[model samples]
Target chain A: MNSFQLEVNIMQIKVLYFARIKEAVNYSSEDVDLPEDIETITALKHWLSKRGEVWANLFSGKLVVRAAINHNLVDDLATFEDGDEVAFFPPVTGG
Target chain B: MIRVQTDDFDMAQVLDDLRKHNPKVGAIVSFVGLVRDINDSAEVTTLTLEHYPEMTQKALQAIVDQAKQRWDIIDAVVIHRVGTLLPTDQIVLVAISSAHRQAAFSACEFVMDYLKTQAPFWKKETNSQGARWVEAKASDDEAQARWTQ
Candidate 1:
């Protein structure tokens, strides 16, 4: 493959958190590269779970979490591509 | 309509905006959520509300759409404020206008319920003890789920 093709093959994914999750993660968002097979939301969480204690603690077990892919609520099987913005948070409490 | 603004709103002006176009409107139900001075037994001095801008507007618009489907309402408006706010300050407002009172009331409550559980907004309260983030309540999900069935 050409160098340009190889560069295009690599994808960037961003994970954002809010409230307690943000505090626990110590970051509002982070960018990471994923293997070609790890394109779904569930797989992404599994990948993030191995990052460290903070991620494992927040994502491990049956924690109540919500996710949005590119600004829309999505199911666990949602797919991602290069430069897709993903967000994670606990249930909302507004109004 | 859904608006996320930092400036405070005038209730009379908003009411007039909703009622001026329709003479058949008989009931107008409105809910104003205030930033309280206390949370989780802590005395809150200031509160900051944060939201994902694009997603927040879309989610609120979806909730308003659902309310429109379930009720025969003439108009609905959702106004939410962000940034630093003090106690007793209005944080959010939901207004519904309909030909009858029950649809207006139910729609207003329904919109608020969906907003509480589905919309993306986080709040942090600062007090003498420092700052504490509010946790998401399980009861909120139950509240929104009731409308599905």
Candidate 2:
């Protein structure tokens, strides 16, 4: 009966929070369980928003939040692979 | 060269190291960003700069590479400081060396302009009133747009 499973799926992704986002979340990083319905960066945010009020408030304004996948800036439409590193941060203010 | 560190940098030393044995460099242009005492009319007392480590290095390298591709500069150096800093402290440096002044000047400005808009660094200013994160201004975007084709 166990042989009926045809594939193994990644159950989690590494998530990083930086700068203001880090302060807001009160943690720098975490291992986020990849929800069965989450397939894209936008979906990932929607999943994270369910974590708590702080997360909901932070992700609710998606316009101000910027994302990077595997160290490169990415749009919401970007796809994520299992074990990929995803970072969420506010817009840069450095020179 | 692109560097991100918490220590202060010596401008003269960086400029000297840039042109070292290369006599082809006839002109050197540089710009330094300093921590100001006032921002958005707040009496800023201190400034803290934060960056995304590996991502910051990559972004800065990409910026300098773009400048090199667009200009005929001999070499460029970017040194940015992080962590806590006081007013009037040096925060960043952009220097370019070239056989002529125009190329060096243009490339140096180009790198700094891109750094302001594209680099993954965040600045928080602590004024007498309170601590606040600095907002990215539209003027910075306009400054970078001027160089685009």
Candidate 3:
């Protein structure tokens, strides 16, 4: 394949959910195609908020939300590329 | 090390594994968290736990690493079970091995505190009335936040 075709075929993003967030979203993870400029965690949150009301409520207000990119905690400025695992959930209560 | 699995683990087996070949290990502290039969006012019969696989393991490892950095712990293990579990069943196990009891105890508690407020797991309880997802407890968060400062 040519370089242009290769670029077009690249997978862009993946969003993973845990606990109640998974149930609310009705998915464990999903691959998404996003524009190149959409790289930060905050931008991804805004894009996902458009998916439905559940997304809006889950991401809305002053809820304490935690996120990880490629299995590491990241701030809103964290960047991602194709095939990176991005996860979101409310504050955890494991123990 | 950390493990996230659906199957229950043997407490004796884990303890033995922690002390098997290590002679310098003078202390081993463990915390076993069981599925409770009550939540708030509800009578809970069972609980279903869910977690983000990659993130859960990574977050756990990070917590363990932090404990090692802050203490003199020789080894640590954290095992959290997912899926449906009955009351009194073990849901999580944290073990810390160190040359001193203080490090062992403190590290074990630190890991639990971090897990309670930072690790990505949720609990849903089912009883005769209905099934409900447990909400985050403010007290638990407060318990964890105190350690940060």
Candidate 4:
């Protein structure tokens, strides 16, 4: 008898939406699982845009939204690991 | 010290606590921002402020730390208010205490300038024309850039 093992790579990340982004998405936060292919922020955004019409429109590169990873502002090219918290929102307008 | 709260702050009490043990401070400069009845050609009756809790605190602390590093100030305090606010309500306050008038004035202005742009707070205005989010001004960015250069 022969036995084989299959390996899989998955990453679970906490995603937060704030301000206008939250209002648009109608969600505050959720945990999402992404495949290994979605490693970077840009890839993740592209992947998330496929969720539905609202997601597609919001992440379609028209909105001037910003992103933060682990509570720190980061560029779209930033990469993430499992269990990281990512946030998206509009430009800050406070003092 | 830094604080982000929905409750209104007392400037006199805050100043008293800030200068309680600091006998070296000679000058205290402060700035208070308030909600206005009119903005951008609209009548603003109520303004609701929103923020990212963790990020907002971190950003405020970082701003104060930068001011401390740049100026020889004895101490500083930043109190920002969130939630629904009516016209004439206090929105933010920045106070800097220093040994001289110059440092206190400059640092206070510097902190306010940075806070306007760097902080992660957003304001939505409810006006006669309905509610809308306030846009970031280029003038604010320019004011902040002057410090970097």
Candidate 5:
């Protein structure tokens, strides 16, 4: 096994999908083992887009997705750590 | 106070509670958002509200905190209801109290404007045609922006 591939399962992060993004992806939340090179929010978006066509549209800016780390909003360049909780959703519409 | 729940809230009781807590308050401004029967040029029957549960409360508190810092408000109360709701159902209530009416009114508006654009809750309306997610408006962003200027 490639050493880099072996490191993949070591870091686990929780990803939450909300609202429209949840309906499109058919998942409310999931646990994803980070790929060795997927370290930042932008990198994670690009990597997840490769999953398939629907995933691509959801993450490739077709939907204006927002990200948050541990309940706080963060920009695309924000880095992730093991066990971090990340959320993605469209812009809010509540008052 | 920030609350997210499925139970319908009593606006009268909520305001009375605020008044009780701050006896010195001279003014209270409250805004109640209701599920409307018409939306986006369609006749709506029911509305569903969804949110990131953990983040929703945190975001609301942060908005209230910002309002507190920006105005001479005594306190803020925010209650948002989720799950299935019918037309005319109360969806949210934002109330602020202060020593003066000017402070109360301004802070109330500031909290509401920020909540419209910043809170994590999303609303979906079901009309005769079907259900659709409420789209974010450029006008909402503009509403939030005016506070800074």
Candidate 6:
């Protein structure tokens, strides 16, 4: 539990895309190692938008996408932890 | 009970089973949602429901748990079918049982309202033109808003 040991622990998370977002991104789920600066869902989304065109379009507020942390719906400001499952999708349309 | 499956559920069998061996069950109110042949003036041939498998069942249970806490309900059942469905096919059923009609009626509607806006299921419509994702209607948000007020 020293500073050097803590620095060796990389933050990893599983990101999921559903429906149209999945289609656009061409990936249903992905594992990403978090950058030290990206601690919140909003920051993660902004970082994801830097990937390329389709990703930028999906994550840059162009398409309305809802997010969930570990299968529970959450706002963009929700903080992320290591090994969490974060999901993004459009509004739900079920009855 | 919450069942998220692709199999079509039989209304009569489901209803009949809910009241069995439970003498206090004096009333049952259920709502069934079916696939529509038309939506937004388009000829919708088929509807596909996609859901987060790990989330759908748990979210449904949470919804019913909320409904039960608010009302004096004996039991509740929620069945939401996923995958591709043809027009006129059954999609969802929300049944609530109680000793009185009022609680049954109110809880049934409450579950359906919450499920529409809160659950993770998404729908896509296929037609002669093409396939497109169904947009979440503002009307649905309005419908759920009524309950909170």
lDDT of each: 0.86, 0.87, 0.85, 0.88, 0.89, 0.91
Best by lDDT: 6
TM-score of each: 0.90, 0.91, 0.86, 0.91, 0.94, 0.94
Off by over 4 Å in 5: A2-4, A7-10
Report the poorest 10 consecutive residues by lDDT, candidate 5 chain B.
B34-43
Pairwise TM-score winner, candidates 3 and 5: 5
Q: Which regions in candidate 4 have their CA more than 4 angstroms from the true location?
A: A1-8
lDDT: the better of candidates 1 and 2: 2
* lDDT: the better of candidates 2 and 4: 4
Per-model interface RMSD values are 1.1, 1.0, 1.4, 1.0, 0.8, 0.6
Query: Candidate 6: where are CA atoms >4 Å away?
Result: A1-9
DockQ comparisons of all candidates to the true complex: 0.71, 0.73, 0.61, 0.72, 0.83, 0.79
Per-residue lDDT of candidate 4, residues B1-149 (tens digit): 89999999999998898778989988899999999988753779899999999898898998999999999999999999999999999999999999999999999999988888878899999987788888888899899999989
| Candidate numbers, best DockQ first, in rank order | 5, 6, 2, 4, 1, 3
Q: What's each prediction's clash count?
A: 0, 0, 0, 0, 0, 0
lDDT of 6 by residue, A26-48 (tens): 88999998866787888988999
| CAPRI quality level assigned to candidate 2 from its DockQ score | medium
Which scores better on DockQ, 4 or 5? Answer: 5
Across B101-130, the per-residue lDDT of candidate 2 in tens digits comes to 999999999998889988889999997778
- Candidate 6, B52-94: lDDT as tens digits: 9988888899889999899999999999999999989999999
Give per-residue CA lDDT, model 5, range B14-62, as digits (tens): 8898898667988889999998888763789988999888888889999
User: Residue B33 error for model 1, in Å?
Assistant: 0.5
In model 1, the runs with Cα more than 4 Å from the true position are A1-9
- Candidate 3 lDDT over A46-77, as tens digits, reads 87788788888877645657788887878788
